[model samples]
Target: MESMLIEKSVQGDVESFEKLIVKYNRYVYNIAFRMMGNEEDAKDMSQETLIKAFKAIGQFKMESNFSTWLYRITINVCKDELRKRKETVLSYDAPLNEDEVTLKDTLKDETYNPLLIYEKLELRSSIENALNQLSEDSKSVVILKDIMGYSYEEIGAILEIPIGTVRSRLNRSRTTLKNILQIQLSEN
Candidate 1:
């Protein structure tokens, strides 16, 4: 079913493309959120990735996984945005927006234990903080393989690196995150 969508999308069928979006939007948003750290930037990056993917759909290889291809675009779009943000300055005087929402906000379930929820949220927040400390390459590998559950081979295809490189980078990324997290836990 997905392969059919991919074929039709490549052939410029808009309805097929929209169907594809329905299947992959969540995955794209997840990657973007992990890469960009905040809700607004993640949504922006995800939108850019979708636009780029739509433009380049004709170039995608049918044998490759659609999720893998979309993930690559998401990462590249994020990397570009990071580069742009690195050079841009933020004004401390700028007003703060009170309406910012997060994925955590949407997952509210009164049935869940409040204590369990607090602990999980704290742990996730710590991990995300640690992840932000990693270099982009290391962060990408960790997010792809560990957080998003992509196989090492899929990560290689998404990042355009060798499998061995993926393994090494993931190892180093994990080590750094572990160290950072330990420090956080110790401090707490």
Candidate 2:
């Protein structure tokens, strides 16, 4: 079914292209959100990625799966955005008072106790802070493997790097994240 959509899209069928976009929109936006760390930037990056993909669809070869190809495009778009921003530090601190319910809490089940929700929020913030400390390459590897659940081979293909490099980068990223989290926990 998707292959047919891709074929029609490649042939310049606007409806087919819209269908394809509808199917993968959330997937692309999620990657963008994780990489960019904000809704505005993620939306911009995702929009740009889909536009570029649509323009280049006619040139796309069928060797790789459509999702993989889209991923490659999304990564490149994000990398470009990151470069333009040139911002190093990402602030994870919530501006609201301590007692205020966070956005994370709203998304989670309401049955949980407030204390448990706060604890989870802290953990999530700590992890995000640690992730922000990593270099872009290391961060991408960790997000792709650990967060997005891509296979090592898939990661390598998406990043255009060797599988061995993916493994080593992932190992180093995990170690760095673990050490950072430990330090955060000890301080708290």
Candidate 3:
């Protein structure tokens, strides 16, 4: 069913392309969210990604799965958006200085228990914090390889870099993340 839709869409069937967009919208949105962080920006990025994908459908190589190619395009669109957003530092990095510290101490909510703390640290939030601390190139490699489950070769193809560069970036991102986590823990 999807392959048929892809074929039709690639052939310039607007309805088929619209259906394909409907089918993959959530997947693309989630990827955008992971890459962008903010909901508004993710929505804009996802919309722009779909528009770009539709525009370039004729040029898509059928040698790869449609979703794979779409995902690559989505990531590229996301990278462009990130670049436009300028340099955003990880919120975790700028440790709460005196005013923030006082506010945190005074307005502490009792909602976050150890279990909740562990759960938050287990997935998206913690990983995002770590990734946000990385250089954009390193962040892109790690997000593609680790979060999005792209293989090194696929990432290389998507980024137009060698697999060795992808692997090296992943290693450096991992090391940076480990160091950041260690620092956070020791400070706590």
Q: List lDDT for all candidates, in order.
A: 0.78, 0.77, 0.71
lDDT by residue for model 3 (1-188), tens = 87787779877788999887786798789888777777898899999999889889888877777777887888889888778877764332344332222222433663433224445555446567666666566666777778778888888887778888888778867776655554443345
What is the per-residue lDDT of model 2 for residues 81-116, given as tens digits with 9 covering 90 to 100?
A: 887878774222212123443333444554445334
TM-score of candidate 1 on Cα atoms, chains taken together: 0.77
Candidate 1, which segments miss by more than 4 Å at Cα? 87-120
Residue 178, candidate 1: alpha-carbon lDDT: 60
Off by over 4 Å in 2: 89-118, 183-188
In model 3, which residue pairs have backbone atoms overlapping below 3 Å?
Answer: none
Give me the overall lDDT of model 1. Answer: 0.78
User: lDDT: which candidate is best?
Assistant: 1
TM-score head-to-head 1 vs 3, winner: 1
